[model samples]
Target: MFTGIVEELGEVTRVEPGDGVTRLVVRGPVVTGDAKHGDSIAVNGVCLTVVELSGDEFTVDVVPETLRRTSFDGVEPGRRVNLERAMAANGRFSGHIVQGHVDGTGTFLSRDHDGLTHFAYPPELSRYVVEKGSIAVDGISLTVAEVTRDEFAIALIPTTLAATTLGRNEPGDAVNLEVDVLAKYVEKLAAVHLPSAAVDNGGGEEDR
Candidate 1:
Protein backbone atom coordinates (compact mmCIF):
# COMPACT_ATOMS: atom_id res chain seq x y z
CA MET A 1 0.00 0.00 0.00
CA PHE A 2 0.95 3.62 -0.54
CA THR A 3 0.28 6.81 1.39
CA GLY A 4 -0.60 8.92 -1.67
CA ILE A 5 2.46 10.97 -0.91
CA VAL A 6 4.51 11.65 -4.01
CA GLU A 7 8.19 11.17 -3.39
CA GLU A 8 9.43 11.95 -6.87
CA LEU A 9 8.21 13.69 -10.00
CA GLY A 10 9.55 11.06 -12.34
CA GLU A 11 9.84 11.15 -16.09
CA VAL A 12 8.61 8.37 -18.32
CA THR A 13 11.61 7.45 -20.37
CA ARG A 14 10.08 4.77 -22.54
CA VAL A 15 6.82 3.04 -23.41
CA GLU A 16 7.10 -0.17 -25.39
CA PRO A 17 3.84 -1.68 -26.50
CA GLY A 18 3.54 -5.43 -26.78
CA ASP A 19 0.84 -7.98 -27.56
CA GLY A 20 -0.83 -7.85 -24.15
CA VAL A 21 1.41 -5.68 -22.01
CA THR A 22 3.15 -2.38 -22.34
CA ARG A 23 6.57 -1.98 -20.79
CA LEU A 24 7.07 1.33 -19.01
CA VAL A 25 10.41 2.67 -17.84
CA VAL A 26 10.53 5.60 -15.48
CA ARG A 27 13.42 7.59 -14.07
CA GLY A 28 13.16 8.35 -10.39
CA PRO A 29 16.38 8.58 -8.48
CA VAL A 30 14.83 8.88 -5.06
CA VAL A 31 12.30 6.08 -5.42
CA THR A 32 14.81 3.82 -7.15
CA GLY A 33 17.68 4.49 -4.80
CA ASP A 34 17.18 1.20 -2.98
CA ALA A 35 14.56 -0.43 -5.18
CA LYS A 36 14.66 -4.10 -6.04
CA HIS A 37 12.86 -6.39 -8.43
CA GLY A 38 9.23 -7.19 -7.63
CA ASP A 39 8.87 -4.05 -5.54
CA SER A 40 5.69 -2.09 -6.10
CA ILE A 41 5.79 1.53 -7.14
CA ALA A 42 2.90 3.89 -7.51
CA VAL A 43 3.20 5.56 -10.87
CA ASN A 44 0.64 8.29 -11.34
CA GLY A 45 -1.51 6.61 -8.71
CA VAL A 46 -1.44 3.17 -10.40
CA CYS A 47 0.43 0.50 -8.46
CA LEU A 48 2.84 -1.17 -10.85
CA THR A 49 5.33 -3.82 -9.96
CA VAL A 50 8.91 -3.22 -10.92
CA VAL A 51 10.05 -5.99 -13.24
CA GLU A 52 13.52 -4.66 -13.91
CA LEU A 53 15.80 -2.00 -12.51
CA SER A 54 18.75 -0.17 -14.06
CA GLY A 55 20.46 2.80 -12.52
CA ASP A 56 17.73 5.30 -11.65
CA GLU A 57 15.21 3.78 -14.03
CA PHE A 58 12.81 0.91 -13.39
CA THR A 59 10.45 -0.90 -15.76
CA VAL A 60 6.94 -2.13 -15.13
CA ASP A 61 4.52 -3.92 -17.41
CA VAL A 62 1.15 -2.23 -17.81
CA VAL A 63 -1.63 -4.48 -18.95
CA PRO A 64 -4.68 -3.49 -21.00
CA GLU A 65 -6.97 -3.39 -18.03
CA THR A 66 -4.78 -0.95 -16.14
CA LEU A 67 -4.51 1.24 -19.19
CA ARG A 68 -8.25 1.31 -19.72
CA ARG A 69 -9.02 2.25 -16.14
CA THR A 70 -6.24 4.82 -15.72
CA SER A 71 -5.00 7.91 -17.49
CA PHE A 72 -2.22 5.75 -18.90
CA ASP A 73 -4.08 4.30 -21.87
CA GLY A 74 -2.02 6.30 -24.34
CA VAL A 75 0.57 7.68 -22.00
CA GLU A 76 3.73 8.75 -23.77
CA PRO A 77 7.38 9.12 -23.05
CA GLY A 78 8.54 12.40 -21.47
CA ARG A 79 5.38 12.65 -19.39
CA ARG A 80 5.95 13.67 -15.82
CA VAL A 81 4.35 11.24 -13.40
CA ASN A 82 4.05 11.11 -9.64
CA LEU A 83 6.09 8.27 -8.14
CA GLU A 84 6.04 6.71 -4.68
CA ARG A 85 7.39 3.44 -3.41
CA ALA A 86 5.34 1.23 -1.14
CA MET A 87 5.35 2.63 2.36
CA ALA A 88 7.67 0.90 4.77
CA ALA A 89 6.13 -1.02 7.63
CA ASN A 90 8.02 1.14 10.11
CA GLY A 91 7.56 4.39 8.17
CA ARG A 92 5.53 7.31 9.37
CA PHE A 93 2.02 7.56 7.94
CA SER A 94 2.08 11.10 6.72
CA GLY A 95 -0.82 10.89 4.26
CA HIS A 96 -4.08 9.01 4.15
CA ILE A 97 -4.21 5.33 3.26
CA VAL A 98 -3.88 4.95 -0.49
CA GLN A 99 -4.03 1.67 -2.34
CA GLY A 100 -2.47 3.06 -5.49
CA HIS A 101 -5.47 1.64 -7.29
CA VAL A 102 -7.09 4.11 -9.63
CA ASP A 103 -10.81 3.86 -9.22
CA GLY A 104 -11.44 6.05 -12.24
CA THR A 105 -10.29 9.14 -14.05
CA GLY A 106 -11.17 12.80 -13.66
CA THR A 107 -10.80 15.78 -15.93
CA PHE A 108 -8.85 18.92 -15.11
CA LEU A 109 -11.50 21.56 -15.61
CA SER A 110 -9.98 24.76 -14.31
CA ARG A 111 -7.83 26.46 -11.70
CA ASP A 112 -8.65 29.73 -10.01
CA HIS A 113 -6.14 32.46 -9.35
CA ASP A 114 -5.65 31.39 -5.77
CA GLY A 115 -4.95 27.77 -6.75
CA LEU A 116 -8.45 26.44 -6.21
CA THR A 117 -8.33 23.75 -8.86
CA HIS A 118 -11.53 22.19 -10.05
CA PHE A 119 -11.95 18.70 -11.51
CA ALA A 120 -14.86 16.81 -12.99
CA TYR A 121 -15.11 13.28 -11.72
CA PRO A 122 -17.20 10.35 -12.85
CA PRO A 123 -20.73 10.49 -11.45
CA GLU A 124 -20.34 7.09 -9.86
CA LEU A 125 -17.61 8.52 -7.64
CA SER A 126 -19.63 11.45 -6.40
CA ARG A 127 -20.89 9.66 -3.33
CA TYR A 128 -17.35 8.97 -2.21
CA VAL A 129 -16.27 12.63 -2.30
CA VAL A 130 -17.14 15.18 0.35
CA GLU A 131 -16.04 18.61 1.38
CA LYS A 132 -12.78 18.37 3.35
CA GLY A 133 -12.51 14.69 2.45
CA SER A 134 -9.29 13.21 1.15
CA ILE A 135 -8.89 12.30 -2.51
CA ALA A 136 -5.91 11.16 -4.46
CA VAL A 137 -5.37 12.87 -7.82
CA ASP A 138 -2.59 11.31 -9.79
CA GLY A 139 -1.16 9.81 -6.62
CA ILE A 140 -0.94 13.08 -4.68
CA SER A 141 -3.39 13.10 -1.83
CA LEU A 142 -5.38 16.31 -1.58
CA THR A 143 -8.27 17.57 0.47
CA VAL A 144 -11.53 18.38 -1.26
CA ALA A 145 -12.16 22.04 -0.76
CA GLU A 146 -15.63 21.91 -2.20
CA VAL A 147 -17.94 19.46 -3.95
CA THR A 148 -20.83 19.81 -6.35
CA ARG A 149 -23.09 17.40 -8.16
CA ASP A 150 -20.53 16.71 -10.87
CA GLU A 151 -17.26 18.17 -9.69
CA PHE A 152 -14.95 18.85 -6.76
CA ALA A 153 -12.32 21.44 -6.02
CA ILE A 154 -9.01 21.36 -4.21
CA ALA A 155 -7.10 24.27 -2.77
CA LEU A 156 -3.58 23.53 -3.85
CA ILE A 157 -0.73 25.01 -1.97
CA PRO A 158 2.44 26.10 -3.73
CA THR A 159 4.20 23.01 -2.49
CA THR A 160 1.64 20.75 -4.20
CA LEU A 161 1.74 22.68 -7.44
CA ALA A 162 5.51 22.48 -7.48
CA ALA A 163 5.89 18.91 -6.29
CA THR A 164 3.30 17.02 -8.35
CA THR A 165 2.05 16.71 -11.91
CA LEU A 166 -0.95 18.93 -11.17
CA GLY A 167 1.27 21.90 -11.85
CA ARG A 168 1.51 20.97 -15.52
CA ASN A 169 -2.02 19.72 -15.99
CA GLU A 170 -3.95 21.28 -18.81
CA PRO A 171 -7.64 22.01 -18.88
CA GLY A 172 -8.62 18.91 -20.80
CA ASP A 173 -6.01 16.54 -19.45
CA ALA A 174 -7.16 13.34 -17.74
CA VAL A 175 -6.00 12.46 -14.23
CA ASN A 176 -6.17 9.28 -12.23
CA LEU A 177 -8.44 9.59 -9.18
CA GLU A 178 -8.85 7.41 -6.10
CA VAL A 179 -11.42 8.31 -3.52
CA ASP A 180 -10.99 7.50 0.17
CA VAL A 181 -11.03 3.76 0.63
CA LEU A 182 -12.39 4.12 4.15
CA ALA A 183 -15.57 5.62 2.73
CA LYS A 184 -16.10 2.60 0.49
CA TYR A 185 -15.48 0.31 3.43
CA VAL A 186 -18.03 2.19 5.46
CA GLU A 187 -20.58 1.91 2.71
CA LYS A 188 -20.01 -1.81 2.48
CA LEU A 189 -20.29 -2.29 6.23
CA ALA A 190 -23.40 -0.14 6.41
CA ALA A 191 -25.09 -1.99 3.58
CA VAL A 192 -25.48 -5.02 5.81
CA HIS A 193 -27.82 -3.08 8.16
CA LEU A 194 -29.43 -0.69 5.69
CA PRO A 195 -31.83 -1.67 2.90
CA SER A 196 -29.97 -4.01 0.59
CA ALA A 197 -31.39 -2.86 -2.75
CA ALA A 198 -30.42 0.78 -2.25
CA VAL A 199 -26.86 -0.05 -1.38
CA ASP A 200 -26.46 -2.97 -3.71
CA ASN A 201 -27.71 -1.08 -6.71
CA GLY A 202 -25.77 2.05 -5.73
CA GLY A 203 -28.88 4.14 -6.37
CA GLY A 204 -30.09 6.19 -3.43
CA GLU A 205 -29.48 9.41 -1.61
CA GLU A 206 -25.90 10.03 -0.62
CA ASP A 207 -25.04 8.09 2.53
CA ARG A 208 -23.04 11.00 3.91
Candidate 2:
Protein backbone atom coordinates (compact mmCIF):
# COMPACT_ATOMS: atom_id res chain seq x y z
CA MET A 1 0.00 0.00 0.00
CA PHE A 2 1.00 3.64 -0.49
CA THR A 3 -0.07 6.98 0.90
CA GLY A 4 0.03 8.74 -2.48
CA ILE A 5 2.49 11.27 -1.15
CA VAL A 6 4.99 11.86 -3.90
CA GLU A 7 8.59 11.64 -2.75
CA GLU A 8 10.23 13.08 -5.82
CA LEU A 9 9.90 13.91 -9.47
CA GLY A 10 11.86 11.37 -11.44
CA GLU A 11 12.75 11.27 -15.10
CA VAL A 12 12.65 8.33 -17.44
CA THR A 13 16.11 7.66 -18.69
CA ARG A 14 15.43 4.90 -21.19
CA VAL A 15 12.68 2.73 -22.60
CA GLU A 16 13.42 -0.64 -24.19
CA PRO A 17 10.57 -2.29 -25.97
CA GLY A 18 10.29 -6.06 -26.08
CA ASP A 19 7.84 -8.40 -27.76
CA GLY A 20 5.05 -7.88 -25.28
CA VAL A 21 6.65 -5.80 -22.56
CA THR A 22 8.79 -2.74 -22.13
CA ARG A 23 11.67 -2.06 -19.76
CA LEU A 24 11.88 1.39 -18.23
CA VAL A 25 14.86 2.94 -16.52
CA VAL A 26 14.08 5.91 -14.33
CA ARG A 27 16.46 8.22 -12.51
CA GLY A 28 15.36 8.91 -8.97
CA PRO A 29 18.24 9.21 -6.56
CA VAL A 30 16.08 9.92 -3.53
CA VAL A 31 13.66 7.07 -4.06
CA THR A 32 16.47 4.67 -4.91
CA GLY A 33 18.62 5.67 -1.97
CA ASP A 34 17.21 2.81 0.11
CA ALA A 35 15.52 0.81 -2.62
CA LYS A 36 16.62 -2.71 -3.48
CA HIS A 37 15.92 -5.19 -6.19
CA GLY A 38 12.39 -6.64 -5.99
CA ASP A 39 11.07 -3.64 -4.06
CA SER A 40 7.80 -2.03 -5.05
CA ILE A 41 7.65 1.59 -6.11
CA ALA A 42 4.88 3.82 -7.34
CA VAL A 43 5.72 5.28 -10.74
CA ASN A 44 3.03 7.69 -11.78
CA GLY A 45 0.49 5.86 -9.63
CA VAL A 46 1.33 2.45 -11.10
CA CYS A 47 3.05 -0.06 -8.85
CA LEU A 48 6.21 -1.30 -10.49
CA THR A 49 8.69 -3.85 -9.26
CA VAL A 50 12.38 -3.02 -9.30
CA VAL A 51 14.19 -5.28 -11.75
CA GLU A 52 17.55 -3.57 -11.75
CA LEU A 53 19.28 -0.65 -10.12
CA SER A 54 22.19 1.53 -11.01
CA GLY A 55 23.58 4.70 -9.60
CA ASP A 56 20.62 7.02 -9.07
CA GLU A 57 18.47 4.91 -11.35
CA PHE A 58 16.22 1.87 -11.19
CA THR A 59 14.58 -0.28 -13.86
CA VAL A 60 11.20 -1.97 -14.12
CA ASP A 61 9.31 -3.78 -16.80
CA VAL A 62 5.84 -2.79 -17.93
CA VAL A 63 3.65 -5.46 -19.41
CA PRO A 64 1.23 -4.97 -22.27
CA GLU A 65 -1.79 -4.86 -20.00
CA THR A 66 -0.25 -2.20 -17.79
CA LEU A 67 0.68 -0.12 -20.77
CA ARG A 68 -2.79 -0.37 -22.25
CA ARG A 69 -4.48 0.61 -18.99
CA THR A 70 -2.13 3.40 -17.91
CA SER A 71 -0.89 6.57 -19.50
CA PHE A 72 2.50 4.92 -19.90
CA ASP A 73 1.56 3.31 -23.19
CA GLY A 74 3.80 5.67 -25.08
CA VAL A 75 6.11 6.77 -22.33
CA GLU A 76 9.39 8.07 -23.63
CA PRO A 77 12.75 9.00 -22.28
CA GLY A 78 12.85 12.38 -20.47
CA ARG A 79 9.25 12.11 -19.31
CA ARG A 80 8.82 13.20 -15.72
CA VAL A 81 7.06 10.86 -13.34
CA ASN A 82 5.88 10.99 -9.78
CA LEU A 83 7.82 8.55 -7.62
CA GLU A 84 7.09 7.16 -4.17
CA ARG A 85 8.40 4.22 -2.16
CA ALA A 86 5.97 1.74 -0.75
CA MET A 87 4.69 2.70 2.69
CA ALA A 88 6.53 1.12 5.57
CA ALA A 89 4.65 -0.91 8.13
CA ASN A 90 5.12 1.64 10.89
CA GLY A 91 5.03 4.68 8.67
CA ARG A 92 2.64 7.56 9.05
CA PHE A 93 -0.19 7.83 6.54
CA SER A 94 0.42 11.40 5.48
CA GLY A 95 -1.92 10.90 2.55
CA HIS A 96 -4.91 8.70 2.00
CA ILE A 97 -4.63 5.03 1.14
CA VAL A 98 -3.39 4.59 -2.39
CA GLN A 99 -3.06 1.15 -3.89
CA GLY A 100 -0.80 2.26 -6.72
CA HIS A 101 -3.52 0.87 -8.90
CA VAL A 102 -4.82 3.33 -11.47
CA ASP A 103 -8.54 2.84 -11.89
CA GLY A 104 -8.53 4.87 -15.10
CA THR A 105 -7.06 7.91 -16.75
CA GLY A 106 -8.40 11.47 -16.57
CA THR A 107 -7.57 14.35 -18.83
CA PHE A 108 -6.00 17.44 -17.37
CA LEU A 109 -8.54 20.20 -17.86
CA SER A 110 -7.28 23.46 -16.43
CA ARG A 111 -5.87 25.26 -13.41
CA ASP A 112 -6.87 28.34 -11.47
CA HIS A 113 -4.83 31.00 -9.69
CA ASP A 114 -6.54 30.22 -6.42
CA GLY A 115 -4.91 26.74 -6.36
CA LEU A 116 -7.94 24.90 -7.67
CA THR A 117 -7.06 22.50 -10.47
CA HIS A 118 -9.51 20.62 -12.62
CA PHE A 119 -9.34 17.24 -14.34
CA ALA A 120 -11.88 15.79 -16.72
CA TYR A 121 -13.19 12.54 -15.33
CA PRO A 122 -13.60 9.53 -17.57
CA PRO A 123 -17.26 8.75 -18.03
CA GLU A 124 -16.84 5.17 -16.86
CA LEU A 125 -15.07 6.30 -13.71
CA SER A 126 -17.22 9.28 -12.81
CA ARG A 127 -19.53 7.15 -10.71
CA TYR A 128 -16.69 6.54 -8.27
CA VAL A 129 -16.01 10.21 -7.60
CA VAL A 130 -17.86 12.40 -5.11
CA GLU A 131 -17.40 15.80 -3.54
CA LYS A 132 -15.13 15.83 -0.47
CA GLY A 133 -13.84 12.37 -1.31
CA SER A 134 -10.21 11.35 -1.64
CA ILE A 135 -8.71 10.72 -5.06
CA ALA A 136 -5.25 9.95 -6.24
CA VAL A 137 -3.95 11.76 -9.30
CA ASP A 138 -0.57 10.83 -10.69
CA GLY A 139 0.11 9.19 -7.32
CA ILE A 140 -0.61 12.28 -5.20
CA SER A 141 -3.56 12.07 -2.89
CA LEU A 142 -5.93 15.03 -3.16
CA THR A 143 -9.34 15.85 -1.82
CA VAL A 144 -12.14 16.46 -4.29
CA ALA A 145 -13.22 20.09 -4.07
CA GLU A 146 -15.98 19.79 -6.66
CA VAL A 147 -17.45 17.19 -8.98
CA THR A 148 -19.47 17.36 -12.16
CA ARG A 149 -20.56 15.01 -14.89
CA ASP A 150 -17.37 15.42 -16.85
CA GLU A 151 -14.87 16.90 -14.41
CA PHE A 152 -13.69 17.24 -10.83
CA ALA A 153 -11.61 19.86 -9.04
CA ILE A 154 -9.04 19.78 -6.27
CA ALA A 155 -7.12 22.39 -4.36
CA LEU A 156 -3.39 21.97 -4.64
CA ILE A 157 -1.11 23.61 -2.13
CA PRO A 158 2.23 25.10 -3.02
CA THR A 159 4.03 22.12 -1.59
CA THR A 160 2.21 19.81 -4.00
CA LEU A 161 3.05 22.10 -6.88
CA ALA A 162 6.75 21.80 -6.11
CA ALA A 163 6.97 18.17 -5.09
CA THR A 164 5.00 16.32 -7.79
CA THR A 165 4.88 16.13 -11.56
CA LEU A 166 1.27 17.30 -11.37
CA GLY A 167 2.58 20.83 -11.10
CA ARG A 168 3.94 20.61 -14.60
CA ASN A 169 0.99 18.91 -16.25
CA GLU A 170 -0.67 20.79 -19.08
CA PRO A 171 -4.21 20.88 -20.32
CA GLY A 172 -5.07 17.83 -22.46
CA ASP A 173 -2.46 15.69 -20.73
CA ALA A 174 -3.47 12.28 -19.44
CA VAL A 175 -3.22 11.51 -15.71
CA ASN A 176 -3.67 8.35 -13.75
CA LEU A 177 -6.62 8.47 -11.35
CA GLU A 178 -7.60 6.11 -8.54
CA VAL A 179 -10.81 6.59 -6.66
CA ASP A 180 -11.19 5.86 -2.95
CA VAL A 181 -11.42 2.13 -2.42
CA LEU A 182 -13.57 2.57 0.65
CA ALA A 183 -16.19 4.45 -1.29
CA LYS A 184 -16.35 1.69 -3.87
CA TYR A 185 -16.93 -0.88 -1.17
CA VAL A 186 -19.63 1.24 0.43
CA GLU A 187 -21.43 1.56 -2.85
CA LYS A 188 -21.36 -2.17 -3.38
CA LEU A 189 -22.80 -2.81 0.08
CA ALA A 190 -25.56 -0.25 -0.38
CA ALA A 191 -26.58 -1.78 -3.67
CA VAL A 192 -27.05 -5.12 -1.97
CA HIS A 193 -28.94 -3.85 1.08
CA LEU A 194 -31.02 -0.90 -0.08
CA PRO A 195 -33.33 -3.06 -2.16
CA SER A 196 -33.92 -5.43 0.75
CA ALA A 197 -34.69 -2.51 3.04
CA ALA A 198 -37.27 -1.21 0.56
CA VAL A 199 -38.94 -4.62 0.42
CA ASP A 200 -39.11 -4.76 4.23
CA ASN A 201 -40.90 -1.39 4.28
CA GLY A 202 -44.04 -2.89 2.66
CA GLY A 203 -42.61 -2.20 -0.82
CA GLY A 204 -43.70 1.42 -0.24
CA GLU A 205 -47.28 0.65 -1.40
CA GLU A 206 -48.67 -1.87 1.16
CA ASP A 207 -47.90 0.59 3.94
CA ARG A 208 -50.34 3.09 2.37
Candidate 3:
Protein backbone atom coordinates (compact mmCIF):
# COMPACT_ATOMS: atom_id res chain seq x y z
CA MET A 1 0.00 0.00 0.00
CA PHE A 2 0.96 3.63 -0.52
CA THR A 3 0.02 6.71 1.46
CA GLY A 4 -0.64 8.76 -1.70
CA ILE A 5 2.00 11.14 -0.47
CA VAL A 6 4.25 11.92 -3.41
CA GLU A 7 7.75 11.95 -2.06
CA GLU A 8 9.24 13.67 -5.10
CA LEU A 9 8.59 14.69 -8.63
CA GLY A 10 10.44 12.18 -10.73
CA GLU A 11 11.35 12.30 -14.40
CA VAL A 12 10.93 9.49 -16.85
CA THR A 13 14.39 8.64 -18.08
CA ARG A 14 13.54 5.87 -20.46
CA VAL A 15 10.65 3.90 -21.91
CA GLU A 16 11.42 0.74 -23.80
CA PRO A 17 8.51 -0.98 -25.40
CA GLY A 18 8.40 -4.75 -25.55
CA ASP A 19 5.92 -7.04 -27.20
CA GLY A 20 3.33 -6.50 -24.49
CA VAL A 21 5.10 -4.74 -21.64
CA THR A 22 6.89 -1.44 -21.42
CA ARG A 23 9.92 -1.00 -19.23
CA LEU A 24 10.12 2.41 -17.60
CA VAL A 25 13.16 3.88 -15.94
CA VAL A 26 12.41 6.79 -13.69
CA ARG A 27 14.82 9.03 -11.83
CA GLY A 28 13.60 9.62 -8.31
CA PRO A 29 16.55 10.28 -6.05
CA VAL A 30 14.63 10.38 -2.80
CA VAL A 31 12.53 7.31 -3.46
CA THR A 32 15.54 5.46 -4.79
CA GLY A 33 17.81 6.33 -1.88
CA ASP A 34 17.32 2.97 -0.20
CA ALA A 35 15.35 1.16 -2.83
CA LYS A 36 16.18 -2.35 -3.91
CA HIS A 37 15.03 -4.68 -6.58
CA GLY A 38 11.48 -6.01 -6.09
CA ASP A 39 10.26 -3.01 -4.10
CA SER A 40 6.95 -1.35 -4.80
CA ILE A 41 6.52 2.23 -5.93
CA ALA A 42 3.60 4.39 -6.86
CA VAL A 43 3.84 6.19 -10.16
CA ASN A 44 0.89 8.47 -10.62
CA GLY A 45 -1.34 6.30 -8.43
CA VAL A 46 -0.36 3.07 -10.15
CA CYS A 47 1.43 0.50 -8.09
CA LEU A 48 4.53 -0.69 -9.92
CA THR A 49 7.33 -2.92 -8.85
CA VAL A 50 10.97 -1.98 -9.12
CA VAL A 51 12.50 -4.62 -11.35
CA GLU A 52 15.86 -2.93 -11.59
CA LEU A 53 17.71 -0.25 -9.68
CA SER A 54 20.47 2.13 -10.61
CA GLY A 55 21.88 5.26 -9.08
CA ASP A 56 19.00 7.63 -8.45
CA GLU A 57 16.83 5.63 -10.79
CA PHE A 58 14.57 2.60 -10.71
CA THR A 59 12.88 0.57 -13.40
CA VAL A 60 9.40 -0.90 -13.48
CA ASP A 61 7.54 -2.87 -16.05
CA VAL A 62 4.12 -1.77 -17.21
CA VAL A 63 1.97 -4.44 -18.76
CA PRO A 64 -0.57 -3.87 -21.48
CA GLU A 65 -3.48 -3.93 -19.07
CA THR A 66 -1.85 -1.35 -16.82
CA LEU A 67 -1.10 0.86 -19.78
CA ARG A 68 -4.71 0.65 -20.86
CA ARG A 69 -5.95 1.61 -17.43
CA THR A 70 -3.52 4.43 -16.62
CA SER A 71 -2.13 7.58 -18.14
CA PHE A 72 1.35 6.14 -18.38
CA ASP A 73 0.82 4.87 -21.90
CA GLY A 74 0.87 8.47 -23.05
CA VAL A 75 4.04 9.33 -21.15
CA GLU A 76 7.45 9.80 -22.69
CA PRO A 77 10.99 10.24 -21.52
CA GLY A 78 10.54 13.89 -20.61
CA ARG A 79 7.37 13.36 -18.63
CA ARG A 80 7.25 13.94 -14.89
CA VAL A 81 5.67 11.40 -12.57
CA ASN A 82 4.54 11.59 -8.99
CA LEU A 83 6.71 9.05 -7.16
CA GLU A 84 6.10 7.52 -3.76
CA ARG A 85 7.70 4.51 -2.11
CA ALA A 86 5.40 1.99 -0.49
CA MET A 87 4.32 3.00 3.00
CA ALA A 88 6.45 1.53 5.72
CA ALA A 89 5.03 -0.26 8.70
CA ASN A 90 6.46 2.32 11.09
CA GLY A 91 5.58 5.31 9.00
CA ARG A 92 3.03 7.75 10.25
CA PHE A 93 -0.44 7.48 8.73
CA SER A 94 -0.51 11.08 7.70
CA GLY A 95 -2.86 10.54 4.79
CA HIS A 96 -5.79 8.25 4.08
CA ILE A 97 -5.27 4.73 2.88
CA VAL A 98 -3.93 4.63 -0.66
CA GLN A 99 -3.71 1.33 -2.45
CA GLY A 100 -1.74 2.78 -5.38
CA HIS A 101 -4.32 1.07 -7.50
CA VAL A 102 -5.72 3.28 -10.21
CA ASP A 103 -9.39 2.44 -10.23
CA GLY A 104 -9.88 4.62 -13.30
CA THR A 105 -8.74 7.77 -15.06
CA GLY A 106 -10.17 11.28 -14.95
CA THR A 107 -9.73 14.21 -17.25
CA PHE A 108 -8.55 17.53 -15.95
CA LEU A 109 -11.28 20.10 -16.32
CA SER A 110 -10.08 23.31 -14.69
CA ARG A 111 -8.35 24.85 -11.75
CA ASP A 112 -9.70 27.95 -10.13
CA HIS A 113 -7.31 30.63 -9.01
CA ASP A 114 -8.75 30.28 -5.54
CA GLY A 115 -7.39 26.71 -5.43
CA LEU A 116 -10.44 24.64 -6.31
CA THR A 117 -9.62 22.20 -9.07
CA HIS A 118 -12.11 20.13 -10.97
CA PHE A 119 -11.92 16.91 -12.95
CA ALA A 120 -14.39 14.97 -15.06
CA TYR A 121 -14.60 11.24 -14.59
CA PRO A 122 -16.76 8.41 -15.87
CA PRO A 123 -20.18 8.54 -14.28
CA GLU A 124 -19.82 4.93 -13.21
CA LEU A 125 -17.06 6.01 -10.83
CA SER A 126 -19.18 8.74 -9.28
CA ARG A 127 -20.72 6.30 -6.83
CA TYR A 128 -17.33 6.02 -5.11
CA VAL A 129 -16.85 9.75 -4.67
CA VAL A 130 -18.46 11.89 -2.01
CA GLU A 131 -17.99 15.36 -0.64
CA LYS A 132 -15.22 15.44 1.97
CA GLY A 133 -14.19 11.88 1.06
CA SER A 134 -10.66 10.97 0.01
CA ILE A 135 -9.45 10.41 -3.53
CA ALA A 136 -6.03 10.13 -5.04
CA VAL A 137 -5.49 12.26 -8.12
CA ASP A 138 -2.30 11.57 -10.00
CA GLY A 139 -1.05 10.03 -6.77
CA ILE A 140 -1.80 12.97 -4.45
CA SER A 141 -4.31 12.39 -1.72
CA LEU A 142 -6.99 15.06 -1.78
CA THR A 143 -10.42 15.58 -0.27
CA VAL A 144 -13.41 15.95 -2.57
CA ALA A 145 -14.54 19.56 -2.33
CA GLU A 146 -17.64 18.96 -4.38
CA VAL A 147 -19.26 16.27 -6.47
CA THR A 148 -21.85 15.91 -9.19
CA ARG A 149 -23.32 13.18 -11.30
CA ASP A 150 -20.52 13.60 -13.77
CA GLU A 151 -17.61 15.25 -12.00
CA PHE A 152 -15.96 16.19 -8.73
CA ALA A 153 -13.87 19.08 -7.40
CA ILE A 154 -11.04 19.23 -4.91
CA ALA A 155 -9.17 22.01 -3.20
CA LEU A 156 -5.47 22.02 -3.98
CA ILE A 157 -3.13 23.94 -1.80
CA PRO A 158 -0.06 25.84 -2.93
CA THR A 159 2.15 22.95 -1.98
CA THR A 160 0.18 20.62 -4.20
CA LEU A 161 0.28 23.08 -7.05
CA ALA A 162 4.06 23.15 -6.86
CA ALA A 163 4.93 19.63 -5.85
CA THR A 164 3.22 17.16 -8.17
CA THR A 165 2.27 16.38 -11.77
CA LEU A 166 -1.18 17.87 -11.24
CA GLY A 167 0.47 21.28 -11.17
CA ARG A 168 1.44 20.88 -14.80
CA ASN A 169 -1.72 19.17 -15.99
CA GLU A 170 -3.80 20.98 -18.55
CA PRO A 171 -7.43 20.78 -19.42
CA GLY A 172 -8.22 17.48 -21.09
CA ASP A 173 -5.10 15.82 -19.75
CA ALA A 174 -5.66 12.36 -18.31
CA VAL A 175 -4.74 11.58 -14.72
CA ASN A 176 -4.99 8.38 -12.75
CA LEU A 177 -7.61 8.19 -10.02
CA GLU A 178 -8.16 5.91 -7.03
CA VAL A 179 -11.19 6.27 -4.83
CA ASP A 180 -11.35 5.24 -1.18
CA VAL A 181 -11.45 1.48 -0.69
CA LEU A 182 -13.95 1.78 2.13
CA ALA A 183 -16.51 3.08 -0.30
CA LYS A 184 -16.10 0.03 -2.50
CA TYR A 185 -16.39 -2.24 0.51
CA VAL A 186 -19.56 -0.51 1.57
CA GLU A 187 -21.02 -0.84 -1.89
CA LYS A 188 -20.27 -4.54 -1.98
CA LEU A 189 -21.78 -5.08 1.46
CA ALA A 190 -24.88 -3.14 0.50
CA ALA A 191 -25.36 -5.21 -2.63
CA VAL A 192 -25.03 -8.40 -0.63
CA HIS A 193 -27.52 -7.28 2.01
CA LEU A 194 -30.17 -5.87 -0.31
CA PRO A 195 -31.81 -9.22 -1.06
CA SER A 196 -32.01 -10.11 2.61
CA ALA A 197 -33.32 -6.65 3.33
CA ALA A 198 -36.06 -7.10 0.72
CA VAL A 199 -37.06 -10.45 2.17
CA ASP A 200 -37.20 -8.93 5.65
CA ASN A 201 -39.58 -6.30 4.28
CA GLY A 202 -42.24 -8.91 3.27
CA GLY A 203 -40.80 -9.57 -0.17
CA GLY A 204 -40.00 -13.22 0.51
CA GLU A 205 -42.39 -16.20 0.48
CA GLU A 206 -43.64 -17.03 3.96
CA ASP A 207 -41.83 -20.01 5.56
CA ARG A 208 -43.98 -23.13 5.77
Winner by lDDT: 1
Stretches of candidate 3 off by over 4 Å are: 195-208
Which residues of candidate 1, in runs, are more than 4 Å off? 201-208
After TM-score superposition, the amount by which residue 83's alpha carbon in candidate 3 deviates from its true location, in angstroms, is 0.6
Predict model 2's lDDT versus the native. Answer: 0.88
Per-residue CA lDDT of model 1 for 30-109, tens digit only, reads 99999999999999999999999999999999988888888998989999999999999999999999988888899999
Q: How high a TM-score does candidate 2 get?
A: 0.91
Which structure among the candidates has the greatest TM-score?
1
Give stretches of model 2 more than 4 Å off. Answer: 195-208
Q: Which lDDT value does model 1 have at 81?
A: 97
* lDDT at 29, model 1: 99
Predicted candidate 2 versus true structure: per-residue lDDT over 1-208, tens digit per residue: 9999999999999999999889999999999999999999999999899999999999999998888888998999999999999999999989998988888889998999988999997876677788998999998999999999889999999999988887899999999988887866666656656766432222111100
lDDT of 3 by residue, 1-208 (tens): 8888889999999999999889999999999999999999998888899999989999999998888888987679989999999999999887889888787889999998888999999887887899999999988899999999889999999998899988899999999989898877766656756876532232321111
- Arranged by TM-score, best first: 1, 3, 2
